[model samples]
Target: MGTVVDAPAVVTEKEVVAENMLGDKKVTVVFVLGGPGSGKGTQCSNIVEHFGFTHLSAGDLLRAEIKSGSENGTMIENMIKEGKIVPSEVTIKLLQQAMIKNENDKFLIDGFPRNEENRAAFENTKISPAFVLFFNCSEEEMERRLLGRNEGRVDDNIETIRKRFKVFVESSLPVIEYYDAKDKVKKIDAAKPIPEVFEDVKAIFAPYAKAT
Candidate 1:
């Protein structure tokens, strides 16, 4: 029997816009990735204000979906409780819906593509990120921040937080590496103070600054 060698799946980026439903409008995607307490939320807000980019956080969207008692709620809830990544289909659907309903052209998509499957699934959407904003922080610092957050999130406990960290390191870092190899990652040091951290993020986003 002849051996069948399937080539690895290559991710090709669509730089301008997403075709389906999004029409011909230019859609700029910046993937925001970090650990649980890496302060992705705060910095995303800053980028939105300064860059005119709409922020669509994947985690927040799923949480909202769960709260709405949708069909996926129980499943998502169980997976979250176990610190597992929700199915890419569920998350991707939410992202696409949000993008279609929004008025802005540029977007900062936070806390998504948690694994290679996620990265690959989003590629099918034909809307590739211009760059990946990576918030680099130590596990120690992240643990401290999550413990002090007091946000009442179910995944905020010490045990669940640790599991989330494991998932991030084992799964998410590879996604960052894939972008890095293509020179599409903008790495940021997140251990600094919020203002100082924004200084770095601001520089990266200066090219996208809104005219105000």
Candidate 2:
């Protein structure tokens, strides 16, 4: 007879809090925003290496929830499959968990706040970003890059990509506009090569760079 195995227990938000993951430490956040394939991820990697900030991709966190077999896993998976944004509460919880788990207080949060609801939820937490790093890229260029990315992401198909682009235009842009009105956005021309893009990113992040 084969032995039965139990699934790993899902981590609850309450449990996360019990662990003091969301301690009383002050947090510094930088929102990284762009169209899909705008090289936000690539440049964030550079900033983390040079500036000592942790990179936390919202998409990655949600995907991890799906992998963890949590109760919300199925819902998150469906949303991502349809290129729809997950609920703000779910996303916020994941981001909080990541922040609490990491030792660094500074974070580069990528691919989040897909709409006003997300923005409000995050604001409710009373943790505002230091600045928003906006990566500007043309749709034609972004489409080309997503097609060639070959990262085996389920949402990488042309159909899902188109849906994602539509959502970004309709839902995500306003969040950027809101920060822009506050003069908290640092726009970058991301159409350039990866290295060149990082150069511009480096300049914006220079103030936060850690000395050797």
lDDT of 1 by residue, 62-160 (tens): 888899897788789989999976889889988888887898889889988888999999987777788999999999999999999877888789899
Choose the strongest candidate by lDDT: 1
Q: After superposition, how far is residue 98 of candidate 2 from its true place, in Å?
A: 1.4
Candidate 2 lDDT over 126-170, as tens digits, reads: 677888999999998999999998788988888998998998999
Off by over 4 Å in 1: 1-21, 69-85, 152-154
Candidate no. 2 TM-score: 0.81
Summed over model 1, clashes come to: 0
Each model's TM-score, in the order given?
Answer: 0.81, 0.81
List residue ranges in candidate 2 displaced over 4 A: 1-22, 72-85, 152-159
Per-candidate clashes come to 0, 0
